[model samples]
Target: MDNYLTKTSETERPEFKIPDFIENMGPEQIHERMMASLPEDIDKMPGGFPFDYTMPTAAIASELVHYHLVRGLMAAFPEYAWGDWLDLHAKQAHLSRKPANKAAGSLTFIGKPGTVIPKGSMFCTAATAAGSSIDFLTDEEVVIEEEGRATAAITAFEAGKKGNVSQGTIVLAVRPISGLTSVTNLEAVTGGAEEETDDALYRRIQMEHSMQSFSYIGNDNDYIRWAKEVPGVGDCIVMPAWNGPGTVKLVLVDQNGEPANEKIIQDVYSHIVSEEDRSKRLLPTACSQLTVTAAAGLSISYICTGLIYDKDTTTLEQAAAEFERAVQQVYSEARESGTLIYNKVRSLITDLPGIVDFETFLINGEEKNIVLSKEEYPVTETVSFR
Candidate 1:
């Protein structure tokens, strides 16, 4: 794979390289291409046998080509060719995908004496909104143990923001129980994360290239990048000297793009402290006032209206619902690891379907480019569409 991209013949185009998409093509299509690979002078010369459309010769040739093509693409492509580009680009910095994690929370069971809530028992929220409700399974057995109540940790089967819910929301068991009376979540569920998506990872790898190595305790870029590289962290902000000289304040939001809670703040604080103690921090600051804090929340509201087209019978209410979905999609996309771009939201609304004209668009009751700090997010507090 080392010289995979090198031309089969040096006398050919010196810069010749395979199309990046070639690696992703299926075998059947590659075989078709091979079967059609007759010489330009083929028609001029008599052939012992014409190209065989129903034979394995073309497929066999394509299989070999496919193997080398894939390895060559992985070795030579700028995106995947780690050693020459990513690793060497940022002083040997390598981009790694943050693995997905399951959502976890505590579930309480109230049952009669000698009752047992075995592990893997399922429970969900009372609300029936699809995609909004979460289902969780207990992590272990919870015997009443002579008491009428017990608590056990539970986790969602899938990793995502859908698993995040407030305390006391999970009040129903998925299946009926002989002795169990009721179920409820004791604490708000958090820490569910999907694997780093291709888009997000590409952005991070590109960002690393722009981040120059720091001398001494690094600046805002250094701190922000370091914090974001953490396994569960999604985004970060650094406030240099927030508490006076040699003091730094850091804010982190979870992978869901929500502000860091006490637990997340403490985790970040502990990580920074350990890294600084070991002098592995980006800039190795001498100050110990490196504090971590959760970001402040800002609620936003939206009121939208658009006229139905002349030929369309879609009600205004239906149009409103459609608009709401479109707008939410915009927020959901960037809610994981980046700030919402106001212009992008506006653009998406303009593109919503069944709208003749946009009547009113508001964010926090104003119309402007609403830029958010790295630690801040635009929350949907209210929406009314007509």
Candidate 2:
């Protein structure tokens, strides 16, 4: 608990140390305690007959001391626990590790006419450096037109962070071939997500209670809470009666507040509608129509100005970066679509050090509140400081 910011345990104490008196304790000390509680002449036919190796009591005491030492040590750290504690937590919340997903995008192959590029043709981002290039395989065999460009679907050889590349990033071929010279990625290769991390698992375990389903009133909070139970659903909104009676609309964003991909949307939709899906712990009431979709994305461009102090190590650039990060973290926590209060942003600026006066604070070029619809969340685009 000392270093709470990152849950660090640098100066933690060792739990398994033997007590000083017990570690140095000898047979003589054990005999003394026994003698004090016993009769003076209970068994004194021979020399030290009551407290000898023949009695076996000394050996029993040693065993008990060892038990205490081992138990204390095990209590010191979570790793010492026989099983993975976090794994247990994940099981309770049904939070399983998601496998790495390959980012899917379009690949363009430009070559001579009628060139038959076989299916599973290899291409990468670079020529010489194989690792530097993100490899892709043609999804289907495409025959090129006469001296024209043909696009193919290239699946990454392996799935991981390597495939989460930017748009137009992978342009080079892994090895050159006749009639296949240039290659380009037409769109961003998104949907590539790494395996679920321990931190992510632990966070969800902490929310098991809040995410528990109620008696299926199917109200706004019920829909939102249950919708987020699906993996990769970062945040969600519930619009009750959006399409008149017995209809509800749900909008979801990915864990990073981006639009949910096709796969994610389908997963959410199945969980909400189907009775046999993994997350369909309890099906919704009959006769209620449900619509699951991705929320509209919007960015909040703002300018923050503050006075500079002479001794401050932080520059305006650094402060602006910090302010922008704050907006993303704070605003996304709730993500309730509606009016974004201008005063909340101004209050955030007031707390920053050396900002004696907030000269100009604007959200999307407005000094006052900026209202957003039910399907929008604020994106952290730019934060400028003067």
Overall lDDT per candidate, in order of appearance: 0.64, 0.63
Off by over 4 Å in 2: 1-87, 96-105, 108-166, 175-182, 191-207, 211-218, 244-246, 271-290, 307-321, 350-358
Clashes of 1: 3
Candidate whose TM-score is highest: 2
- Ten contiguous residues minimizing lDDT sum, candidate 1: 7-16
State residue 52's C-alpha deviation in candidate 1, in Å.
4.7
- Backbone clashes for every candidate come to 3, 4
Model 1 residue 267 lDDT? Answer: 59
Residue-level lDDT tens digits of model 1 in 1-386: 24544532111123345666556456556545655676766542223244444246656656666666666555443354434343333334455666675667788888887888889999998766464557899989988757788898888777766777889899988889889998898778876777765435545656666764332446776677667666556667677778798888887766764565554565566666675466644446467578888766557677765643434756556655555545544554454446566667666554555556666677666776555655565556667665
TM-score for each candidate, following the candidate numbering: 0.59, 0.60
